[model samples]
Target: MTKPTLPNTTSSSNQKLPSTAHSPVFRLRDMFKPSFDLWVISWILGLVTALSMITLLMVSGWFITGAALAGMIAVGSHSFNYMLPAGIIRMLAMARTAGRYGELMVSHNAVFDLLKTLRLRFFNRLAALPLVQQRNTLHASQYMHRLVSDIDKLDEFILRVISPWLIASVSLLLLAGFIGWALPLSATSKTIIYLLLLSALLLPLMASLKGIQSAKRLSQVSESRRQKLLAPLAIITQLLLWQQWQAQTKSYIAQDDRLQALEWSAQKLRSSYMLLIQWFFYAAVLVVLFSIYQLTDSSTSLTTGVDVPLVLAVTLGLLGIQEIVVPLGQHYLALGNSISAKDRLNALLQPSVSEAQANSTIPTDTETGLALPTGPLHANLTHVSAKIPGALVGAKEVSVRIDSGTPLIIKGPSGCGKSTLLQALAGELPVQSGEVKLNEQDWFAYNWQDQLGYLGQQLDIFDQTLAANLRLGKPQATEAELLSALDKVGLLTWLQAQPQGLQTPLGEYGAAISGGQARRVALARLLLKPRRVLLLDEPFAGLDNETRERVWDSVREHQKQGLLVVVSHHEWDMGQCDVLTLKENVFID
Candidate 1:
């Protein structure tokens, strides 16, 4: 039962420090541009509301103090004792409560708005990066984590740290000014003293840095270990079948031991930081009390004039200020965590394309008899070579040419660069030495999204309704069009047989469907799209013979309107169609 030891690293060092720091102020500035004026306005309104609430709370304390002193002076007088102060205190409480509720509402709305904008911009940046850049630069799991967990951290940054600090700083400054004006000497002295005390509050934050780093490092190690353990489990389940259960159990135990060790180290670090904060709190309390005594002793005339009730009110107000400042260290630490997360996210958002690289735009001609456009064209690629990470280099000097009403078959061995050529045609692969043209223009000349259809080797089916998955291909396709597409792909009958028909959810990655059925569903999608060109990579690779024949028929039938380029290993009888062999060059043999 003994746990293994995990490596301990300082929290600051453990954080994924950005190669270049982003100015939070610059981020804020970009957010406040004309396009995001509404968000800027919302944030301002929320800050104003929060500060207003703080002011209301301070004012309520003042009124309560005044009322108490009045009551003490008129102890025997029924009207003074019973009426005025009670009414005033009730009103003040109600007002303060209303302000607080309003502040919370506004602040939450502001944070939510910011979150939406940030997520959208981040996704857009990720989308704009070249496909090759994304494939080589990022991990699927890590990108997923950044898209989800890092955004949540950004929410905390806005709601807990940034917004609150703005409100606190503004409110404190206003409150200090008010205090200074009312009791000049005492207020000025206390304001200076409080400012000094604020510096001490940062001590807890400095101490917590160690814990923060430890927690972040532990989190990363835990994630890495979990993935490592799960990867074997994933492979075993798919490949080994019977022995997976026992093997997975043993691996899980080892991973769990390492995680446990990391958890222990994190807990120890957190506890140490908390202990230091507690000591700092005690010191802060002592300082506040000592300052209070000094103020009362030095200004006896003012103290008598203000009375015990006023002193108590001022004391409570000061205590509120202390409460706000004391936990600033913890807040600062959270801010640091947020800063680290933001930096990581921002790095992901940087542009991956280079302007100086002209080789990515080169073009070549298709080797097959598939007609290259005489006039304007839909899709073309020249000398395109795609190198997928971990996969062999794909399709060197690949040149494809197709226009409307031409269908080409690309036959090659498994991993012989057929799919890569297909992707290059679709403008989804970076051209290493050639140009890709779509619609008689350079592929990069215009948006290629609506001009082509791509069915990758793996069918990316989400866990959603059959209809929903199809809709992803062509969102505006009519119900009749959808039924026609499904019918053409020979999936309409099976789809209708399901209890919920189109509404029935496809399990994760279409696990509920047979491999042939998944391929048919993908075909149905291709049929639904209005794109002028289609690039299919091994669409029928996993299907049975009968299903494969049916899929080929569907492809041939659809070949009359749009250009079709298919990559396959099967000896497809593509009657009278131009065939391209990848062994050397495009050919009719």
Candidate 2:
């Protein structure tokens, strides 16, 4: 076994500490404030785009009417000019096209920025989780689903909630003011404006509230499908051979069908909202026609030429509101889902009650300070009891002392607490009673995570290059350092046989490599950066005898400087090492 020099194992990727805001909505609000400049650009583009669209429609109407009138004047041998109307029409067309492009680009950019910040916060919480917490997920908790899907839902608040709500409100205000200016003395125009705005408000509100139950169901079923069905892809063949795949697949498909049904129902509600908006739109046009009639009759000062253009522009502007308003009818359910997603993610990301209160002031003698342990690293568990996560009983009354430069091998029968004992030593499982200390102090006193390296029973390999995966242990590790670690694990020859070598991409879950190779690769990652105490669970399970001896020799080199606690079922001659055997009789009935 050979050991090479290693860089410091300091982890600098700790996430930004969470704020003290109580509400998830408020937390999301605080996150969004930093991107205020991007949002402002998006808002301005949205406003400009909506107004240009309204102008486009209104001007088109005016030009068509004016062209007809001019043709009549030409037939009557009277002079008429077409240049001004033609020029305005061309200009409005260009502005409308450009404005639409700018709005899509800027609004999507802001939405992307918001989502990027939010996902970073959420992922940091995942990265900072303790090994014990990661091992406790065999029960039905769809964390990945929430991290990806639920976090993605939050962007709806940007596109569906913020943009539509604010943009439509601004367009309504501007349209009302423009109409009021066109007919300052017309009472009928004021009434039309009031009704148009009322319909805009009511339609969105009703559609939104009506679909809340359906949206909640959608989120719940999607998560269930992810946890119960999609997660079992690894064992799909075993399930098929057992003849249970049909029932399992049918159950998952049932959820898909239910989701589709709810979506169809939501579409019906949106259609209803659209019908209502159209009815109110026609009513507003009728009111404009009536206002023009009153203007011509009461003033006798306004002619057909003046009253006609005013009526067309005001009516078309009201109609153009549907451009900004009708789409919101489809968004209410998504908005509700986004609110729910925000709450779920916030709850998951918050520190535990104990850690949350750790920030409060305490006595000077208190053991909460962050400092490296200077003396020999020793792990002692005194009469400590521990339970398997989500279970009532596990290892009981376990006591042991692990000192630096001494390797401990845990051997046991099938039902023994060997694995749980390793977990307690590594601080992966909570001690139900008594204490587990390092260097005569609580483990928390010694720069908590920096003192322990735990590789649990399972192998975790990401779909990245061999070099990138190795760097998870020490992000600044060099290419030569990675090759050296691989050689120590008996994989250097195998790596050189491949063209890409360290740069080769591993398929998802390391499927492109054999199972033994995956385990060795993970082991190589652990060996790259040694810690004060190492807890490995069955590291030799899949490796051949030769590779096992080589790997054990590699681990022994590090044991000369730190404590080694390994959990394995098969017996081996581990000379000069303290061996502890645990039986299930103590904790089981």
* lDDT winner: 2
Best by TM-score: 2
Residue by residue across 367-440, what tens digits does model 1's lDDT show? 12123233434566666665444554567676667655667888876556777776655555554456665565
TM-score against native, each model: 0.68, 0.81
State the lDDT of candidate 2 residue by residue for 255-281, as single tens digits: 778778877877887787877777777
Local error of candidate 2 at residue 551 (angstroms): 3.6
Model 2, residue 540: displacement in angstroms? 2.0
lDDT of candidate model 2 versus the reference: 0.70
**Residue 557 accuracy (lDDT) in model 2:** 90
Off by over 4 Å in 2: 1-26, 70-80, 129-141, 183-189, 209-214, 225-261, 293-306, 351-378, 391-393, 460-488, 491-513, 528-530, 585-589
What RMSD value applies to candidate 2? 5.9
What lDDT does the true structure give each of the candidates?
A: 0.59, 0.70
